[model samples]
Target: FLFSLQRKSIVAVSFIAAFLCLIIVRLTNEVTFPLILNCFGQTSVKWIPFSNGQRQPLRAHYGYINVKTQEPLQLDCDLCAIVSNSGQMAGQKVGAEIDKSSCIWRMNNAPTKGYEEDVGKRTTVRVVSHTSVPLLLKNPEYFFKETNTTVYVIWGPFRNMRKDGNGIVYNMLKKTVDSYPAAKIYVTTEKRMSYCDAVFKKETGKDR
Candidate 1:
């Protein structure tokens, strides 16, 4: 009789544990989906003009150049191609095919000058990594001043792009724009960056 009772107790405990697990899973699903849905594929935030609290000095020798607000690209094209920095495309001979697309997006500091036969010479947008900012700054005059029409979207951590005056990369980019006066560089907003982190955490169930 005691053995039978112990068996019933074990079965009861197992049933309760499973029931709790199911409830926890249901609750997590309910909360996780709403938060992640808002961040799905969000790469940048709106470019509203920064207030005094959010703005900082460009620290130019001539004068300060304030970061201007701008809107995201409103492409009306039906076909778009995202070109990644992959070595497989080194000799793919797809330059003509890539150029045929209505719009193109490139990642990081991938150049099209030498690899035009494989990656095409046209670039609608280049999504730059934060680490490449310093490199671009080295030749800011040539890259930003000379090519004033190329649009660049840079993404990085909060410390690199923050407006609290401590953002090293942000200040450097501001200086570049101040000198060039016509360079087009867009830094991802903090909100979008946080949302991206949240999405990553939710998907991985760990902090990014």
Candidate 2:
């Protein structure tokens, strides 16, 4: 009877080992961390498509996500997605504040046409009421001069944002003070400088 009991235990252990081996084989896959965006009271996600410059259709997949929401948003077949250069901290501010302001502004205001639109770029949604951003220089009086002479504010003699952003903003002031016809254009980082006819950091209307 004792010998028979030992045999039975051996068989049970072998069966359990085999079951674990099967599970290991089935679960052998690379684990990939997913990117998530928390919005409103739920989580929303969109698939990003890969582009090849040629007029070819892109491919995408619904990234893995977990959230509890009553409604699921329908996704389009296109892969064109916009994201900010900022990191996680900035993203929180964007969703909390920027999104609200942008909603109201778009409803009552019209988007400006004829300006060169940025590719693969996004704007932070503004939320706080009447929290106006001083779009132009500290002193708009100098940046926009009303005179017989045409003074163009050049963009960049500096290239990298860390390396060139301050130089670009500061040199605009220098050009106005020096009374120069051609100012350095700092907008483009193709690492080249050119002349401009009329330039403004941002345009604002009296109505706004």
Candidate 3:
């Protein structure tokens, strides 16, 4: 009986180990496959045949939609440096170093004009929140007209970003585009926002 019990314990341990290995494999695949796909420009977006029987490339980056062209945002970069507005970078003086990256991402309304020594002067992309839209509008010339080359990605709750003529932020963005045709602006799709929330929950074991 003792021998049988010992055998059972060993089997249980082996089973647990196998389960852990499976979980690790799944996690690794989830994290790595998306990156691989992005690197090869084979993201979730797929090519579809047009009405004229011609296949068109529907390029997208994680479900971000370009407001002007009404197509998916197509962007690629070798390296990206995300500059935060946190005070921790006050004396870092990493501006020149950050500027060396192929792409520089900034958060909403974070002005680099005054803090060019710590934050970088160049901005390839700017992720803005719905609440910060008005703040940006306050300086429309600086944010939309001046930085026309920079891509703008906006994120917010569905109510504020919806397109049924009820989304305040969406309407504002539409007006901004009409005002500055050269501005490159994109908004996160509802599905993409849900996916981000799912990822956050999966990683932290808590709802985002």
Candidate 4:
């Protein structure tokens, strides 16, 4: 009877070990493989193909020298503060308050040095307009190179956003890239800008 009991216990332990091994193998096949592939997969946006054999130009084609090479911004934060360039923020002594957030956002080449009492010194992101490109380019070394390290998201109309080789702002950015290699800039596509404008118009009854 003692011998039989020992044999039963050994069998149970072996069966349990086999079951755990099977589970680990299944998980690796189903979950781990795909995750590994996704991690190292091609991250660049593919050009759209047309029936007439012409392919839609990518944003990189518009003269964004390092745009394609740039990795997408990944945020994992609990709080974010979007600070716009509105006149109302001029007098507010909320710099200390704004600095508390995990991420701080500002807009359109706004000066933060003198206005540090109102606006915080830490700039996580900057939302720039198409019209502001020329101004930013004029002092790229100060804004983009020397002092600020803010991520810039430039938005504009279809003509300026398009990658059709005639995009004025796109050309400007291309030239800026040649001039300033250290700046981090991302320009929005025409379709995305149009959608945002439509949403803004619907919400405020005014064109963006």
Candidate 5:
């Protein structure tokens, strides 16, 4: 009789434990889903045990956000977000940034902190077949040619703290050498700031 009673106790305890687990998971789901549903593609989260019966929050590392570029198409681009997790998740949204959390919504337009970088290694400039660009931009003497050179460009001030804020500088210059193999290219600043100037001169054949 005692053995049968012990068995029933064990089964009862098991059922209660499972029910408690379900409750915890449900609460976590409500907190993580409705708050982060539209942001990224998240299928599920798996929780694990820690020391002292403590449970760690589920971690979804990748595929959190997709940043859409501006009007003109671009290859080198990013987005930004705000995340907060200090037992203080209320008050205001903007106060909490995304990088702070294990999740991210989009890439930002600022550089990271503490890195030696250059200007030309910052943002990107792409060239395609149908881009409203020009070929030989002749301004009096110099014939600036935009040949079969399509690329992703990044130019930076190199300091993470830009515009008086913290940022980082990462130059993704692989597109140029990889895409335009054997295409002699010069990414020069003297290269007009606006495409309007380049195209106008090309159409008019005018000097500076």
Candidate 6:
């Protein structure tokens, strides 16, 4: 009887040790995975769990917020291709290849209509500066009306992006959305813009 009792105790101890190990591993991943992703310039990770026990990828709260909806932007892409409008891409002819990516990101007011051979035709996200807002508005029919499905993430100082009727750029964007209701426009929050500057400074050791 003593031998049986010893064997039972051993089993219980092993089970307890395994459970503790699992908890440790879970905690480690929750903490370390986000740091790893941040190093790669990803604003958010994909392992966040919901109340229903479902996992969903989430962008940082400081990231883009929808202009019309006033809600956080929720977007996840397995592979993203950032298309740059550089002279080096003149002869690349990689439009088809870039289009294969799950998401394509562009900067400023780069247009891919004529240069579709080098830059992909589809734009998943466009990061525009306040100064470039005029360039985009130059052809609202092309940028806002036609590419209504593309998400626009504008970054600017609080002075230019504020919504209190004093922000010039914000007022322009508000008018754009009013004209084109289908446009998906988001502006980076002040916190997000500052976070971006911090990341840039950390990476380049120079203020942006």
What are the RMSD figures for all models against the true structure? 16.5, 20.4, 13.6, 11.5, 18.8, 7.2
- Mark the 10 consecutive residues where model 3 has the least summed lDDT: 23-32
For each of the candidates, give the backbone clash count. Answer: 0, 13, 0, 0, 26, 0
All candidates: TM-score: 0.61, 0.19, 0.70, 0.65, 0.20, 0.70
Question: What TM-score does prediction 2 earn?
Answer: 0.19
Residue-level lDDT tens digits of model 2 in 1-208: 9999999999999999986665444234222223212322223332232232323221221221111111222223332223333333232433333322311211101121221132111222111111111243344453334431211222233331123345544444444445532322122222323221122223432221
Mark the 10 consecutive residues where model 1 has the least summed lDDT: 56-65
Deviation from native of the Cα of residue 164 in model 3, angstroms: 1.4
Q: After superposition, how far is residue 195 of candidate 6 from its true place, in Å?
A: 0.9
Candidate 6 matches the true fold with a TM-score of 0.70
Residue 143 in model 1: lDDT: 67
| Pairs with steric clashes in candidate 4 | none
**Candidate 1 at residue 58, lDDT?**
22
lDDT of 6 at 9: 100
Model 6, position 72, has a per-residue lDDT of 75
Q: Identify the leading candidate in terms of lDDT.
A: 3
Q: Can you write out model 6's per-residue Cα lDDT over 91-150, one digit (the tens) per residue?
A: 799999999998899999987888888887999999999999999999999988944689
Model 6 misplaced stretches (Cα beyond 4 Å):
1-62
Candidate 1, residue 10: the lDDT equals 100
Which residue segments of model 3 deviate by more than 4 Å? 1-59
Question: Following a full C-alpha superposition, what root-mean-square deviation does model 3 have from the true structure?
Answer: 13.6
User: What ranking emerges by TM-score with the best candidate at the front?
Assistant: 6, 3, 4, 1, 5, 2
Model 5 is weakest, by summed lDDT over 10 consecutive residues, at 63-72
Candidate 5 C-alpha lDDT tens digits along 1-72: 999999999999999998677656644444444333334343444334343254544443221111111112
What is the per-residue lDDT of model 3 for residues 39-97, given as tens digits with 9 covering 90 to 100? Answer: 66666544443443544443458589888888888666678999987989888999999
Ranking of predictions according to lDDT: 3, 6, 4, 1, 5, 2
| TM-score-superior candidate, 1 or 5 | 1
